[model samples]
Target: MLNPIDLHYEWFGVLWLEEENHFPIIVGYWFSKERSEITQDAILSGFSTWTEIGDHSMIMRMYQSIRNKQKKQDWEKRTRLSLRTIFNSPWNEVSPGLYLIKSRDTYPLHVSAILKKKFWVWLEHTAVCETKEELQAFMQRVHEEHQMEISMKNTKPKFL
Candidate 1:
């Protein structure tokens, strides 16, 4: 099985050509990690970890800095209701398959981006905070709740 590998010197993942004697051309980054596969051309071109940094409002000009920008404006623009936008600043993953997003326009407008992967990906989410404390609390609560539900389902009581 062709597993996605993390890129060197970056916090991202990439799929490289495994064929020996062939250039390790990137295929694509891990998007869903489910049913998503690298396309022929896409494999050649490849993709990096799509991270956002710097002033993403209108693309700021930077001189020399440690942090770098990785947002694909063109791609994000095409995708509607994107978690990241001029309005929404902090959109992050709280847990695996779960994302917590918030924006200034809708202050305290907590939204969730749930990754439903049947074949590829279908993001589904519903609301929290800009603070790390709030985010952590929210995530912990959700995780506990989910565990409880799973436990309940597994423990089938036998009626006397």
Candidate 2:
């Protein structure tokens, strides 16, 4: 049996973030009836890539240290939402370190796709707000997009 509330928000939406680095990484996470499936594809098969370039000089040193072993940069999970990040992806990159930060908040809404196995989504990384007010604005825009989807589904074209 599934909880009514959980079932309703299971299929919210999907977004991907691709960070540019020596070894680029693309992560796609989906929300399923199983919370374990909410990984958004953070699984590790071989080597991992660190997206945030927090302290440029420090990151450079970290890069040097892991340059051979692979997956060097150590990231701070708590500040993924407010750091200075640089996203080279085609999606709308926003802020400096936002790609790593805001990506965490996405937990509220489940993935929007039917994911079978872990895969990569090339959607451009973008976060249009920094503060709560700004986040609300961005969310409002998302809401509008959601309404558009619903509207399209509910309405049908007339045949002459």
| Cα lDDT tens digits for candidate 2, 1-160 | 1112232345321223445664433233234665444334444322244343335465344333432232111111112211111222211232211111242243232111110111222212223232467455544544453332211111111100
For residues 78-141, write the lDDT of model 1, one tens digit per residue: 2224333222212221222433333333223343333322222223323234345754565565
For TM-score, the strongest prediction is 1
What clash pairs does model 1 have?
A: 27-43, 110-127, 110-128, 112-125, 114-124
Cα TM-score per model: 0.23, 0.19
lDDT of each: 0.32, 0.29
RMSD in Å for candidate 1, one decimal?
18.1
Instruction: Kindly report which residue stretches of model 1 are placed more than 4 angstroms away from their true locations once superposed.
Output: 1-96, 102-109, 119-125, 147-160
Candidate 2 ranges with C-alpha deviation above 4 Å: 1-125, 148-160
